[model samples]
Target: MENPPGTIGPGWLIKVSSRTARPDPGACPTHLRTAVRPLVAAEPPVPFRRAPREDFAPGPLFAALDLWEQGGWSIGRVLDELRSTRGAFRGRNAPAHPSLMAWTVQAFERYVAARHEEQAAARAAGLPPTVPVRLGWTARTKKKDAPDARGGQQYEHTAWGRQYASADGSVRDLWIPSLGRAKADRAAAEKAAIAHVMANGAPTPHRRRGDTPPEDATASTRLPERVRVFDFGCADGSVTPLLDWHRTEVQNRFMADAAPAFVSAATGAGTRPGASCVDCKAISGCAALHRTPRLWGAASAAPMRGRRSVSAWDLRLHGECPAQYHLVRQLHLNDLSAENDGARRGRAVDAWLNQRHADRPVRGCRDLPIPDASSLPAAHPLEGPLAHVAVRMLTEHRVLCPLNGIGSNEQVLVQHRVTAYVPELDVVVLAVPDLLYTRRGDWIWRETKTASRPVWEGRSLLRSYPQLALAVLLFSAGALDADPRRSWVELEHLREGRGESRLERIDPSQPAVVAEAREVIADLAQPLLDDASYEPTTGRHCHGCQARTWCKPGTAYVAEHPQGVGRHPDAAEADHFADRGSIHA
Candidate 1:
């Protein structure tokens, strides 16, 4: 049998093949050996030191290395012992457990020995060894000024010296591998773990022993003194962690100082009133007076009107200009067919309601046992005329009608009003339908009889503005009415049929909120009015506009702002000219 190219004994030499290097038939052994030598010599096998049996203990490799260092074993002896204990070396297929231990221990030992040797050599020559000096890592303290050489103060590794100086001044880098990349991965994992804990309370890889508080526990606390107000879209929850840390630190400090009094108070032991009271003052004065506010109150607040016009004119103008604000307000209705498995579920629901009412004759009803319809009828109704009406209103009036556009465009106005007598609690959720209302509030949710069924399941369908806005308006009204607890607005998406909702609880004093709400409402109401100059904004909406054929602005806008619209018009023109020239040439 003939051996393959670049093979010497059992080992193979990886090399580039060439037509000229092709072996001739009946080549001599001497010629073959000559051909393979250069290739084999070009690439040498990597030589690695092995670890001893002692290093292969269950503990971490570093710890094992530390033990070996203390024992003062020579490098050669250690390698020999490791090989004998772990079994004969099997090249690449060797078990990782022992190999990892050996690699780590040997690497550390070699590094230490190399440094010692270098030092000894320097000392013998009567010269100082090149030892690393501590130099602190720099951090950005302020904005860059043109002439400032030292940008910011740095945190130095006082013990480790310049050898331990991280690329970034962050201390976390020193203990981890591929500092930035590893830290990022670990951070992402931690964030996901925290979110999991919040959503489902699942155990995470970061789970530690003992009673350690969560990273976000302090921020989650309803304490007054540690309260720090933040604005919307403030760098993706950066302040939340800081606030949480600060809160924990403050609480820990306070508890440490007043430990005796706190323990005494908890045990009902006799304690000086003034002493205990002084420590409790901060807790008592907390702005978050109420821990859990009335859920009903939070639910009743009116929905703030979003800035999107459901009118035709606004749609047309939006189709033309497609401004950033317009894009922000624009609602993209999910394809019902795709979303609900080709059922056209919304339309089917509407049809059911329409058919149920078609044959019913008007009659006087005094008293009768209301027919039970579906499960959970006692709790609320399902698949009834009311549900049909909501579905119809959403699909036909809201979805089909160009005038109504998307209901998301309609601004649900909300106000944080003082409804209760609580002095401390000022924030409340309020859900309002339209701005127009009477003194006692308008009738929103009215009880209507279903033709086919009597009693339905689940809560009543919010038939009117008052009913729809009940969760936001009334619930929030009660929350703000008293100073008992936290307040938040819950935007329920009934259309998705998934029962998914978004909650945004904000401080009452947040200035941007009211302004944002006002803007949304103004945009939504645009289509309702007679705006002659209303042109279709053609950015994102042009693709979805039902009346795209009739929309002149949509056509013109797309033409003007082609895909990949660059800031420099001249550059775009030049590119176009080049393309044309290339095609001709």
Candidate 2:
């Protein structure tokens, strides 16, 4: 079948990556649609060049597997070859970091051991021996059977992962590798991937770009009796089987069930303008995204830096410790540690409130009855005293629900992305208010925060909650396209106790308010933009820093401060229970 035409819209030859075809529950519907149905631009968007370490593990790891399959090389020989060549396997051009090379070598050793153990177990059970196969499978629906079935659209489904097959082709296994801890894939997606591969599975291996397929590059005559999917943990060398399905299960249950969802995602409409806008092919004409240039009021003297994004959370982290921001935000490294109780409670409360406010017909929470602690769902994050606290916080939210004053026809966007760009800084300023609504054509930004303690006494609201400061600047600059004279930025602080919630509204039209917001933002953003070296600054944030394991300075500081307490008088006295949640939430 020919590739889809270079057009962007809901109906077209939809190309779906079975792995990401169905997005998470709260993911942007527009993003999924756009991705599957991309416009054929004259000049395709340039892919970002990630750090060398990010690409190190997977390439060498797969190459080692191929080498093992071809030559049956010993583990020691494999490691020696890889180390000697510095991972120039498969003609890789990018340099590998020394640390990453060491990590990958260890990962390969673990992977081989795990693979051998699995093979041994299979042999003991009288199953045929397995061999590594690199082929990817694709399942396609005829143009007549596409989402717009009658409109002549075709859909192609494909899965991504390491592949293996029994010598007799009785069983096939898809190994999904993770550099860190093994995480479970979404159930629907996993099933869909299995269905896709099984429907058109072949013994052929994956070919690099421009590589010619073998003479027998066709679907396997005999389908595997059993399909297995495993998530391989490279960090600790653990193998977790995620799915085991018979051919009947894939055809009768999984395929029939997943087809509709896959179609719905591909045909999804509506623009959700946020981080996705940065790379969206249709962004130039997207009316959904509101761009406010220079909203941060901070310009970088270095104009050569590529475009990047900054949020209130980024600002706060950079303000506290630059290294934490870089490691956690930029490199996307994590220690896989559990969050503290207070932080978890805050998230639970926020989720609960968001769910309630998202109800149809624009109903307010003022009249809704609060749930009792005992009735809370087991799956709910709230538990014990924290459940009670979350319940109480919900009760406090009743009085401050933004929907109370909103009309049914007025726009109500809950946790919607509001973005701005700072051209001078060559950075995007991103903000997602907890709730945004309009009254008589005036835009109102509401940020709901859960705190165990009351609002910090005598502290500037903008200083305490920098999101409100960003909100103010956005409204002042007319980013939201509402009446600037009446637009307001609101902070609804919900405390644990009854009747302790505070609702403070700032008039963004005022010059003084805008000045204060600008100052607050600049104070946090200037150092982040100007500083190239993200040096670690030890303080209270290290206690909750997820990237501490990767930062020597942070690790040392944490060791010295075993109690996770800060010695700084000002920060030590700061309210630690406050929620520093993500606005890209």
Each prediction's total of clashing residue pairs, residues at least 3 apart in sequence or on different chains, is: 70, 3
Give me the overall lDDT of model 1.
0.26
Q: Per-residue lDDT for 58-125 in model 2, tens only?
A: 76677777777666887788888777764356555454433344455777888888888988987898
lDDT for model 2, please.
0.66
Candidate 1 per-residue lDDT, tens place, 449-517, comes to 112222223632221111222333333333324211233322212232222222222322233433443
Q: What is candidate 1's TM-score against the reference?
A: 0.18
The lDDT values for all models are 0.26, 0.66
For all predicted structures, in order, the TM-scores are: 0.18, 0.76
